[model samples]
Target: MKTMLFSILAALLLFVPNAAAHTYISETTPQDGSTVTENVQQVVLTFEGKIEEGSTFKVIAADGTAYTPQSITLVDGVLTGTFEPALPNETYTVKWDTISQDGHPLSGEFGFTVNAPVEEQVIEKEEESTEQEAAPSVESTQQANDEDAEKSTSPLLLVGGLLVIIIIVSIVALAKRKKA
Candidate 1:
């Protein structure tokens, strides 16, 4: 009976730390794997618990350029970081490394694409067709518009779908860990 009691106590002790290992991200600005039409000057991540001061956030552009925020401020479990002017039409990944309140290190990476404005896309196409012998017909322009819309929306749908799957899996894993 003494041995059984000791075993139970040991199991409970081992499970406690795992349960409190890290704080979960309650929400984030721009969301994970989303596309923003407007300029994004900053990234904000909100956690369910407090984050330590030593936490770091990084922004990496698709061209292999990495940027550190000009400022990082933590207030009421929300960490906000300001960066330079909006990145042009490109995908960027925000990588974060932070210590949870429990002292465990947690890190994650999320991506967002900054899409060019509709006017900008139209201007670029106009410039590209400057050398053409004939003006584009109305039907051809309509078809091009449809194609562009499809191209832009397809990636967003894929990314959104993947994010949903990830969130569902994470919730299940967390639930199981908490139950343990």
Candidate 2:
């Protein structure tokens, strides 16, 4: 009986650390092995648990251009790395390193492809020139002003409604007190 109890306790101790092991990447933007048609300005990694401050990631293009992140931030178990000038058409490999909450070092790598067509770039340039030449119409300006007014009034409307409710409740409470 003593030997059996000792074996069971040893086995339980071995499994406990594994169960509470380091956190891992639960989800990633531009998911691994995916082909995207749009510009990728940021990469986001969501971990199974909160990550430490030193966590970061890098992007390497197929042409061997290494794009370091302009900024890295962590919030609620999610790490985001933003890159300037967006990623062009290329197959990219993302390498990341992070420290888990348990003080263990963790790292991973994933690949994705960006393939934005050249024709869209030309069209976007043409649209920008045309929009620049066009002046804002009177009706559009009025609509924008109306939208701003609505946004500014929203909070005021909510506060007014709450004040009215409070006054009504106060009056009812005073009436009940006199009756009692």
Candidate 3:
């Protein structure tokens, strides 16, 4: 019986670290796989737990132009990175690396497209010009919105999966204890 209890405790100890090490993003500005209609001046990441001092993140434009944050601040579980001159209209990928409160290193990357709002151009029509300005199609907008919804739920799914694993482990341990 003692051996069985020890085995269960050891198994739980192994899983505990894995659970504690995950410091996932709880919220973000310019969310993953989203389309921003205005200039993005800053990126904010809210984590599930407090982060260390050395935690940092960067933004990379689709054309390989990397923009380092002008200032980064960490307050408890929230990390905010600000950029100067605003990010130009381009698809950007945010990559971040941080040390969680548990001292475990965590890193992740997510991409978003920026479509800054443009001022309407005033053109003097000469002899009834028929030129028309192009606009985004409805289908494309719908697709982008759908993608954003899918990405937003990803963190929730991760938490649900972890809960399921823990529940299964608990059930198994209880069964073993009963048998012993």
Candidate 4:
């Protein structure tokens, strides 16, 4: 029985290719760990799989500052999101979550560094008017954030819950068999 269980688990893991593998950043605009001489107007991230059309993508800096860009654009299977303005010298983190053509919501993160200072980065997000914004609602953004957190939680809890139930059932069944 143990061998059979192991086999099933191995098979499941094999067939279910890491959902992470299905979507990956193949090439980034700044590239990983690259030091940029000039300021970058956008933090473009290109993925291995095609992002679902009209999906929301986001980039967050390592210092916990998020790039609320002007807009996110998809071209020829590549996702390029334009930053509100160029950022200053510091380590910036890029995070993205989007539904793939395969229908799975994929999300991941990476970081890059810029040599500039903070003041330059601060002005970009301010260029846009808070009142006449064309971006998605804050409510929708919050909902997506909640869903992303849940995705990170569901699989672990599911496996643990299943294992607990299986052990309990096996113990009860064995006790009954011995009594008989």
TM-score of each model, paired residue for residue: 0.58, 0.61, 0.59, 0.54
Residue 17: error of model 2 in Å?
7.3
Regions of model 3 farther than 4 Å from truth: 1-21, 120-180
How do the residues 62-93 of candidate 3 rate in per-residue lDDT, one tens digit apiece?
99999999999999888888775567789999
Q: Residue 152 of candidate 3: its Cα lDDT?
A: 43
The best candidate in terms of TM-score: 2
Model 1, position 174: C-alpha lDDT score? 65
Could you tell me how far off, in angstroms, the CA of residue 61 lies in candidate 4 after the best superposition? 4.3
- TM-score winner, 2 or 4: 2
- Judge candidate 2 at residue 101 and give its lDDT: 90
Q: lDDT score, residue 92, model 3?
A: 94
User: How big is the positional error of residue 52 in model 4, measured in Å on the Cα after superposition?
Assistant: 0.7
* Clashing residue pair totals per candidate (backbone < 3 A): 0, 0, 0, 3
TM-score of the candidate numbered 2? 0.61
Q: Taking the tens digit of each residue's C-alpha lDDT, what string does model 1 give over 20-135?
A: 44565656676766777755567788777888988888889999999888889998778888755445577998888888888877777777787758675456456546853221
| CA-lDDT, candidates in order | 0.65, 0.69, 0.69, 0.60
Tens-digit lDDT string for candidate 2 (40-117): 668888787888999999999989999998899999878988765567789999998988898877777877888767
Name the runs in model 2 displaced over 4 angstroms. Answer: 1-17, 122-180
Residue 106 lDDT (model 2): 75
